[model samples]
Target: MKDLFDYCEFGDLKLNSRIVRTGLWESEREKTGNLTPEIYNRYENIAASGVGLIITELYSLYPRDVFSKYSNTTNYARFVREARDLTDLVHVYDVPIFAQLGMVQYSKKTEQNIAIDDVSIEDIRKIQTDMIMAAQKFDYGGFDGIQIGLGNYYFLSRFINPNFNSRKDRYGGSTLNRLKIVLEIIKVIKETTNLHINCRLNAFDGTTNGMTLTETIEVAKILEKYGADSLQITRPRSPQFFTRENKEKNPLIEASEQIIKNVNIPVILGGGATTQNQINEILNTTDIDYISMQRPFVADPSFLVDWQLEGNGETKCKTCNNCYWKKTSTCFINRSAKWDVKSEIPKKS
Candidate 1:
């Protein structure tokens, strides 16, 4: 019988392991969104290390709306081809990559912003078309799928908070309506490409009046019904992870349990995924199809290989979270150097 970690179909991608290298960005790209060899090598290395699926950091769907300081890849002509090359490299390692896509909104708190009100339906159409085109290109480049990203919402998470999207139109009002845009985008991409589609939705806002698990689960069920290959869920930080502490209680984990009970498609839970026991518990205890590991991979891309092949207890990583602060995506305690590779895939004799 095939096990949970065994080769399985996730959306369009056939994954060999249940471990997914989730998105963590540190502006690793050049000024343009094109990927440098170093960045390609960084991801390819993780693929070689046994990450079943790789979802790149949130990449913009539109060209000019780039905001926030963290460097990222863009779909502009300058780097689009080179960005495709990165996907090709991952394919070489027998690992599938998903080009995580998103569009950012300027913070009204700042000097000025892209008023959601002013965004011409024509502009939205062009933007949606671009996303569809990008997903097609990712398929041409050998990627398995694309994960839709919610642009910096803590920057605007308050708006999606159900408390703030105080509007009369379709984009706002109800949680289902605010999320219709994402579902519509997925529909467009699916119509454009035959590749797998993975949709990521913010699961919790970490506040009472904010989007609670109830509303998110309702939305997730709809994504599953709409042919989403896989669904990745995470808690959107309203302020920052530094300010929010749930150590005494793991509400995120509880929410994951609730979601898994409702949906049949593979569900990925992101945020503070540290330690073997926690991951095992999610898999062993719930119907969660897989795990989305971030900081751990940054700490050591080989963390997957070591944990599985060596049977080494407790990831050598302390989860100190320094790599997170640096925003470099490279861990302080366990850079790729800390890994001592011993196993080799054998040649057919």
Candidate 2:
């Protein structure tokens, strides 16, 4: 069984532990979408806290593109000269960083939600090129890898999910057809860049007609075949929030175990995994290579640090889901203003 503190290797990434800081949205950017000092502080704390890897929040590849449909407040073209500073700062702690590159930048509730059936072949081609270009920029900015957002009803997930995708073209109909674009993205990135490529993929979405674990297991196999370095397994949020009954046992864990068995690449199993005992049980029992958490880190950036020193199984985060509602990711329990949330996004008068 893999121990939590043992060194881990995934492609080119080396980490001190099996713990990964999963990407959490922090709307703490300059209007120009540059990383603010406050964002830097949060990262520094996270890095010093001893998490194995840091996956930055999903960043829009093409902030201004009509097809991309990013939120006005959160969308900013990434990897500007200033953004390079973030990569540099995180590397200072010898922590590998992966930027989550999301093709269609939609929040759960807002922006233009494009139906998958409406996407055209030409648009798909254009997006493929754009994503590659974005990956190149991230490599240039000194990021360790790019985690493609292929989950959570994002643009790519919409394409992958048959319930949402309804086209009769080559990019639709069959499972492999839906996976072609992602396969292409991984192949081109491997050819063009030395940066590691991982994917944050939905193992399942808990909807009547949505994706299931069986299909996602196949998706993981194909992604590994296409040169993806790792897979971060997650589930799309249900229409309602998870209550005690559902949150205690994440259904994704069993699916992630199934995927890990099938794929050679490292698998990051995360979502609703809150305590040290739970993570320990996961690593000790399963073939899963790593564990990741988002809310625990937000509620307490030092959660790992505390666990390391004390060996306690508990986390400070209550998983109230309040952090998502705030302008920036802040723990309602702590009530500390740790980020600089830009109060007003300038309107075009």
Candidate 3:
């Protein structure tokens, strides 16, 4: 019988295990969006820690956006060539890596701030072009896959959510029309590149008018129809962080199971899975192809190693969102050793 540690296939990409390290915001990018040594070391640690697949922190397709100071895009060829070193390093550990591409909103500090949902058709087209170009460059950089991040309330997610998108134009009004931007991106990538494309769909949002699971499920079907290699079912971030008492029973599981049953493509489920037993139960019972974790990995990069060896043990992560405040995504519980950058930078959350 196949276990979580066993090899599996996601479209053309091969994985050493079923545990996936979902994209976490690591504010460790260089000026030109090149992979910094710190970021490289992080990936190396994650790859060496026994996770099967790794999705890198979101990379900005349009670097000039206001929120893109940390993640930027410049000369694709040069950036890709330089980034090949990080890819080769992770590959050495037999872990497949995926590059996540997202668009950023302008910060209040920027003079000409623009909201993600307020973008015009031409701007949307430009974003699609940037995304396609980024995907091509990531393929050149030796990534096993590229993930279209329609989660975390990013540009793509804003468009996908009815609550955020109020436009009556082609990019809004209806769910399919709202999804036009991402669908176009997927089509272009499939037609133009060899890199396997994955999508992180925001299945639900906490707000009243936010996207619903049914609509997201429909989107997943269309994504599969349009040649997406895999679907990662995620949701918009909760306003409050998690704790041991309020861990919320894998909030994404029910919807993810629905998506897995509907889509032919593999579905990666990640929400509040902190224990090995929860992971095993999810994989064994549901049709969910894999389990992805973000905070747990932040709290312990060797989480998979510990889980596999011990069979079952609670993660040390308290879900205290403290590490999320740092640009480096440091765990506050173990902040001293892993992230010791002493700076006066104000915490985000």
Q: Best candidate per lDDT, number? A: 3
lDDT against true structure, model 2? 0.73
Q: After superposition, how far is residue 324 of candidate 1 from its true place, in Å?
A: 3.0
Error of 1 at 316 (Å): 4.2
lDDT of 3 by residue, 1-349 (tens): 4467767887767787888887656566655556677777777777876678998876766556634565545354468776689899989887889988876563333435476566767777777787787888888888888988787677778877888888878888887887887888888898888888888887688788887888888888888887888988776663243456774566778889888888788888865677877677778887776888788777766656555566686777787777555544557786555622123212222
lDDT of 2 by residue, 38-147 (tens): 67888877776767898877676666533222211223455446557877887887788888777553322243555777766776778888888888888878888888
| Candidate 3 ranges with C-alpha deviation above 4 Å | 64-67, 70-78, 106-118, 238-241, 337-349
Task: Rank the models by lDDT, top first.
Answer: 3, 2, 1
Candidate 1 vs. true structure, TM-score: 0.83
Every candidate's lDDT: 0.65, 0.73, 0.74
Candidate 2 segments exceeding 4 Å error: 62-78, 104-112, 238-248, 337-349
What's model 2's TM-score? 0.87
Instruction: Provide the lDDT at 158 for model 2.
Output: 79
RMSD of each: 3.9, 7.5, 6.5
- What's the CA error at residue 314 for candidate 1, in Å? 3.0
